[model samples]
Target: MMSVTRPYQLTDLSDLMALSATTNCADPRAAYGWLQERWGRVAPVELEPGVPAWLVMGHQEICRIVRNEQLFSRNPHNWRLYNEGAVSPDSGLGPMMFPRDNAYFADGDKHRRLRAPLDDGLAGLDKQRMSRLIRTTCAELIDRFADRGRADLVNDYAAIIPMLAIAGLFGLGPEKRHELQRGLLALFGSGSDSQAGNETVERILTEAIRERRAEPRDDLTTAFISHSNLANDYEIQQSMVLMISAGYETTKTWIAQTLRLMLTDTRFAGRVRGGRMGVDDALDDVLWRDPPMANMPARYALADCEISGQHIRRGDALILGFAAANADSRVHTEDPWLEVGNRAHLAWSAGPHSCPAHRPGRLITRIAVDTALHRLHDVILEIPADQVRVAPSPWTRCPHRLPVSFTSAGAS
Candidate 1:
């Protein structure tokens, strides 16, 4: 531990790297390595420009912070900068970092209370029905471009399937589903349109809640509206927001990343095509190497403490470095044989706030990947892997586009 502990001054801002830039870089692992070498496990970083926070990179250190709620809380209300009125409502971080009524921003009993509706709503999901919905959505999406013999998988396929399937569960029609998808993409992009996007999402979800209350149906929206744990309309809407945004972004990224891996890495491509390794193996491998939610925001320190020799002040924000922790050399190795079937990565996160939708997320990703690979013969990236661009955001590391060419019956 390098015991350096004092409040950061404005002058210190020049030295801190923006967290978003690191993850958006060509080699994030190298960026993480540079941070670790310079500042040990916990390194100082900026969310935007002067908005400072610590990015926790060590696997053990992250486990400690997440597992002990007493020391670190998920509620963003504890964030010093936000409480100090430093973060503007119009800031790009608003959609992601601001406090909300959902479980993602609550702590203790309230967290469990808000989380129940999501847990129950998802648990009540008809797995077979959901799978069928996903498969059907996949086929429909592929048919749109299958005839052209080429497609941008990220936009045309990976991005659309998750939202469409999720909307199907909400019993939304095509118009509303498309509306919801557009809103969420802008919201997660965390750009100038984020606030507007958020408003659109809230409005759509609010309408769903109102309809469900008036005439309940056999859908997740109705299930959420009727869940015993949800107390009021606000809670219900926020819960849906959390479920849809989190599920859509993460699952979309998982599918894109897995496809990228299978298409780029001959180890996976040959094995998967040869029946030596399963698609599940490739999915699991992506979780370890490139999790959808590369850096999760965030946990606030409840009390001043020391971690990895750095003095963490009370109310300081700590971003969970999932991608970095997954690469922790102490827990991971370069040996490909040893990595197969390994489920030790922090991609799904850990502790109470760990992703509750893992089963459904995996189910969705697996079906989407399997269906695409099987249907699109000889699918291959149109550009070099290094040329692929990732969407710019403070939290997730998703590809912006994945253009590919393949053989189809309609291609003459």
Candidate 2:
């Protein structure tokens, strides 16, 4: 275990905390090095006003906690603060930390049971067919704004593709598809109505569940409804909500971030000049520096344990500092350009609860970026790279808008 210079402090815990569910989430980079200098790897901190948890920044330490399900659990119900009634149910963090009936909040056998349907659903997808769908979808999205020679790539392109594709997979039509997209975007919450947005998404998904139950289709909703583990309609609805939210937000961020990287980063010049990187390289870089989910919330310590010299009490919540952990000095190098193919970053997390949709997410992102770069000539960021505004979320650090200028294909 590493030695700690100062013990974790709770003074000013209320003032120091920030909500972890918005684009406005605290930048881990700002405090990662500082925390490492003092508290070493695992540092104690407040998740919100009067809500405390450990921020695990060490790469190895995060893996240890994620993999050891017996020692640590994903169930937020185990959280001492929530269980003790310190973190109120109506808090902004409720959307993330509060318990749900889905696989995201389950543990052990229950987790496996809930997760199996999701795994089976993703596995059942035809890779070539999905790729074709993404390619066609990207082409159409590009065509919509290609003539303008400028567009908000985040909203106009990256944001729309994943939901459409995922909705198609779920056999939903245009009405439900658009509603799901709107609900999901609002669920990420730039405004004060995040809880309402959460309710909207649940209501929409519940309706979809009911519709699928009455008229079965060859889709994910059908699969969830029929899955043996999910016994009730509410369970099915929750599972669908999990699938849609997970698929939608994560992919949207991944696509937007990768596109942002390609346009702004000099290394990925998009045309392979000298050692200019490709879209896949940019994708890897995003996973390392700015993953879709910067910090995943609420893993409770099953019992008293020490991780990398930080003492964690039983039922204490630990935030998997994915962005911070990826930059851990011990495992990750200081120079980003040095390790080209190195993929040790914990972007999709580790252990049983690791992202199940990573494969499809990568495929969608790769195709979106590839098609956009090829279809649009000489794409460049409309705003200065540093000035690009991110949405207000504590967990995800996605750009709110990625406006860019490009030569029209006809002009080129």
Candidate 3:
């Protein structure tokens, strides 16, 4: 089938399909039918003008594609639309959809080689130290607005924790972490200037890599610099890009979504305040309902395949509809009460490409949310719950700003 292209100026945001518009990430129950009614388990969707792909929305079917790497490759080189000259190389989507030397875009032995250093780097982190860093960071962040009695949690707290923690782990100091945060925000924003931001991130990481090589440090950047598998600076830079970009955006969303649930959802609000539901429980709920990355990028089919009766042609791109899969009626129960401790959601994805930093990500989020609630007494949303706006993107769905008001009587 020939690819259909939509007409629009390259500068327009509409030129790119906005995935966040399809459903509400904060409360996905209202949007369950969006994907379910499209095509049984897999649906055809537009990925902007002239680009098309299949979105796998079923739980079991997503598992099949992710687990069976032989059939579905993660390499962007295999994408039919891009390879066939339909999607432009300079298209804003190039950063995510194009091939790179990192594990995110590689497969087989090369994938393992690029992935090992990251796994090892994260494995070596001191959990106790990380906890201290997060608590201290959260405390300081809260202190900034404690006197004001109000703050945009999304920008003031939830948004900054991950980058600070991750950057510290990567061995960057306070100033560099702020710089990294800015570059990352722009890269993930997917706005008209996203490509420029992507290039800036590369330059920042390249400099960091060069500095790390010159003077070794106890950070992830140094680990990547010394890792044997990554042969060049470009490879190391791309690997850092993968780790930082993925870690920052996903964990930020997790923090914001978890906070949203605790503040707005009565079921969780009551439990969290009364000590009936732990922060971990709230975090788990967010994973099932509003995962950090709602719709992951692409997984190209190496050859013809069929999933849930949908014909997948060779070189076709298939998106892992993780949020959709979690809500699949087949494996997921409709009742929230019964789902206590049932962590069957595909939020971290599965198979070889599953998120490796989930442990630390959870640690940062848990500390941030727990610290805020502990410090802020009688916290409440300043605006109506339904008034919160989500950022425009084809990937994750996260609250743009969570303006919250609370009493400081509980502050130490």
Candidate 4:
């Protein structure tokens, strides 16, 4: 059901335009009939005349590209993206996601510098301690919501858990946790009124950064302060907000997606609840059947380079098919149409600009799903299976809301 476009099929600008217009295959494999109709192997369908960065779909090709970091990258702008009124690089959010060597943004030496603080925060006593804390947080949340099965899964469970867990990781004390959570919501939740909400977030975070810098605490905020390279309070604050916001939202989506599936698939639900499979495996199944779609928005070309026999020129914006790549049958041992194991998909992605929080995210995913399965052993999602929908962002896919009933594992 995977379709890569052929160059001959889309021979002209009109054809390319039509192809782009007609293509709405977010997770094309999610609907096989549609995939069979629209999907084809990617040809020299020119994004950049000669330098075609193969939009790999079959699991094998994605794996190959992932392993071959020298070939592809997560960096957004090697080429020019159309002008969208972005501010100058030196200004606020200018040295942001693009062209920054900070951990996820920078490659080579810059990335090494960025990884230190995260490694410190996650290393030694802290890492072990954070896991237990996450477990406790999950238990506490389940205790609070188990009796009330009508809670919103996205907000009540998935959204809140990571905030609390990360807060604890940063050693956020009682009062600070709630405040940090609010700051996070305002910044990340592009709610109905995002403009005002985001400005409020920036204002509060900048102020908080100043305060934290003045009276340095043991949290990641203070850790950023500890770093000599992160001298300016604004950059440190902005970067943290950026990383945490992206990290939080994507993780939230994955959890909600997996939990929703368990709710909808009673047999699958029983398999996890009855301890017939590991939580690791369940997480794998989640990625294959309903992976995140929030990986959209990309960078422009940096130079004219040839990839897979295609010429990619500077100034072109390229979109990678992350979800499709993960599900491609070429790399999958099982029938590509069926649910599969975690064959190490690009859910966390790979490469220098790959997600740095992959370590924490995976462990966190395991802890959350494992804890939930142990406690809420019989959650059955109430929505009709076929009618359950996946919301399409340019990148991430998340259930709108998961409604379910459950048989509690007994009062904790």
Candidate 5:
């Protein structure tokens, strides 16, 4: 392991780009490319203004980081800034980077213990039942705007379906599911309402857990409550939070990005609509070019080390650059023909903490996208693709809105 001889100075910090700012840009890849050109694979980044961390952009470099957890731990307690109290409690990064009882912030044996319930809960899911739920949810949502012939694909369709499907798996009623969806949207937004959203999510899950405990039902919530690994109510509640939030956000983004590609990219538009290329191809392509979670938060250095020639000190934070790594020339090519079925991209990430819900996530996304295209005739973007904006967040780069127009389903 190697270390920098001196601490980073204010002058050094001035040159680093704000990670959130870069992701919020319309052309983030261009900015990421500039970072790679100037700083190589590992570059200094600020999660918020003045808070420094390393953003690992190289495909191989990110692989090395994720696959070797001994050197890089998922536990945020190891983060020097957070530990030193330098990171404000009210900082926008709190909801994401702060320690939680869930598996996302755990490491080693504890991580395995916390993660078991999620895996087991997901394992208990009946894929056939889930697919049907998704299809039904999609139909109901589309029915809202299908007659109107104009829709914001993101809000009216893509964003609503995943949560409703997930809610069905948890056995939540319509009212509760919509409430959970609203809370999660705010929590993931990482804005002023994030803390309030976190509270709302916690309250909802706690109530659901209590309900499941009094009388166990054959649903994911009951499954989590009954899992041997979950020792108490708090653990069970946190696990539910992790599963629902991660699953909803990722699936929503995946559906939106895939639809965005199909409507905007000529290569996909021509083939998918003409039935020349399958929707699955477009989904895979989105995973490579614009993954649901563009930038993930994060891994902390367990010991001083060097990555791609950049010296990192012990307890330093490392943000996973999934979108940037996918764009790495070493692993990915610009040719659409070559990118269609390639699954090597780190979209689901890698290692022990890799996404547990990817299978369910994909199923939900596929059904939502397939149903939308099938029901809507000749759907086209209302605004140019280049003018489309992404929601502001330090992690996850999904379209803010995808307004599209199409033939009314009720047309004569």
Candidate 6:
């Protein structure tokens, strides 16, 4: 398909068949940079595809589309492209969130109903309980390599915390625990090769759902199934999908990127360590500077809408760049491109689907960050970042390996 462009450019629309064509999951930002270069202003620009669609980029525009449920919808196109194949009429994921059919997909009440149980599960911080678990995990990991002076930050440390925390929440066992940490990394991680891995990962989750049903245990999975009033097995499967997607990918990226950012900008790192930049500023800085997911795909139009002066045909798929929009200066007076964080940005999202679990997610992030701030005496990059390996996926960014050295640890 040909790349989409504004009417001013004399490009052939026939070349751009649909939204999927321009998007290369391997390196999405490349195409984003290309499109941004083609048309000016980071506002939601149409990619001039065979099918009429608009990608909301600027901060305000993304906010507009996500909030305007009346006009924009998650199931915009009749067809959605996935790794295996294209799903139409039905989401292929089956009667789940963002249903393809208009009535089910567009109904706000339905969305709220589904989120109710999920919301309840997210409640109850139990800071004392959770903090103890997090610190212990970090301490154990640090002990393993304290003398080695080298560890892969993502695998050896950061990635393990969420799963362990999530495991405690779910009460998963060590045997056949089915670690979502690595699974999600592969699913949304780099390379087309992951398609096969994604399939296997989904299958494992599917099997776990089945086993949990027959022999329900005292865990988050059992709690979710019983609490959700789920219609059938597929819905149960979707919960696993949502939890893994929400809990794993984003958290991993944030940790990897945050450490890297602090490495490059020690001044900022010093501020965080000294309790000067403080928690809110430090977290906000990373949220603005290194958001996990850059853009989210497959938003349906609830009704025909116009954004940034373009007439979007109803039901047309709208692509949104959470990172780009958050970084756009139009919505923020401060120079966002400079990676400054005096102002907040929309990394997770800003509208109805703006991430209901964001509050808890932030708490978990705090545990990790605080562990580093108060525990590790100083920052040490074992494998100079230039030598550290990078994962190839484009939609989300994370370091495959962040070898590092740190002083003997202590607790806050």
Task: Please say which candidate is ahead in TM-score: 4 or 5.
Answer: 5
Model 5 sits at a Cα RMSD from the real structure of 3.5
Which should have the higher TM-score, number 1 or number 6? 1
Q: Which residues of candidate 4, in runs, are more than 4 Å off?
A: 1-27, 30-55, 58-77, 84-103, 107-112, 191-196, 199-218, 293-299, 306-311, 334-342, 407-409
Q: Which 10 successive residues of model 5 have the least lDDT summed? A: 1-10
Clashing pairs in 3: 5-50, 6-49
Q: Candidate 1 lDDT, tens digit per residue, 1-412? A: 3333443433266688889877799899988888877788888999997799999998999999999999999998899899999898888888678988788888999888888877788899899988888888888888888889999999999988888888888878778988988898888777799899989988988898888889998788999889889888887777777787778889999999888888778888898889887888878878988989899899999998988877788989999999999988889678977866778899988998999989989998999998888898878899998888888887878888999999762211
Q: Looking at model 2, which ten-residue stretch has the lowest summed lDDT?
A: 14-23
Q: How many angstroms is residue 218 displaced in model 3 relative to the true structure, after the best TM-score fit? A: 3.3
Q: Write the per-residue lDDT of candidate 6 for residues 145-253, one digit (tens) a residue.
A: 6666566678887777776666555545543344554565565544575676677667766776677778987556676677745666676666656665567667777
Best by TM-score: 1
| Candidate number achieving the greatest lDDT relative to the actual structure | 1
How high is each candidate's TM-score? 0.91, 0.87, 0.87, 0.75, 0.91, 0.73
Better of 4 and 5 by lDDT: 5
Ranking by lDDT: 1, 5, 3, 2, 6, 4
Q: How close is candidate 6 to the true structure, as a TM-score?
A: 0.73
Which scores higher on lDDT, 3 or 4?
3
How many collisions per candidate?
A: 0, 11, 2, 28, 0, 14
Q: Candidate 1: what lDDT? A: 0.85
lDDT tens digits by residue: candidate 5, 1-412: 2233333422257767888866789778997887777677788888887788888888899888888989999989999888989899988888678888789988889999989878888898888888877887888888888778899999888888887788788878778888888888788777799889889888888888889889898789999988899999888877777777678778889999888888888877788879887877778878887888888989999988888878888898999999999888888677977865678899999999999988888889889888887888888899998988887787888889999999765321
How well is each residue in 1-412 modelled by candidate 4, as lDDT tens digits?
Answer: 3343433322133323111211234435543323323434332223322222224334454444445434444465543332333324433223223554345555446656666656554543256767787888778778777877655666678888777777665556645666677766755454565566566556656765777768976567777777776647665765666556556767777788778767777788778778886677778777666666423334344555543333445554444556666656655665644534436666766554556576677777778877776677556667786666655343556766776667664554
Give the CA lDDT, 0 to 100, for residue 171 in model 4: 59
lDDT to native, each model: 0.85, 0.78, 0.79, 0.57, 0.84, 0.59
List where candidate 3 sits over 4 angstroms from the true fold: 1-20, 24-34, 89-92, 186-215, 333-338, 409-412
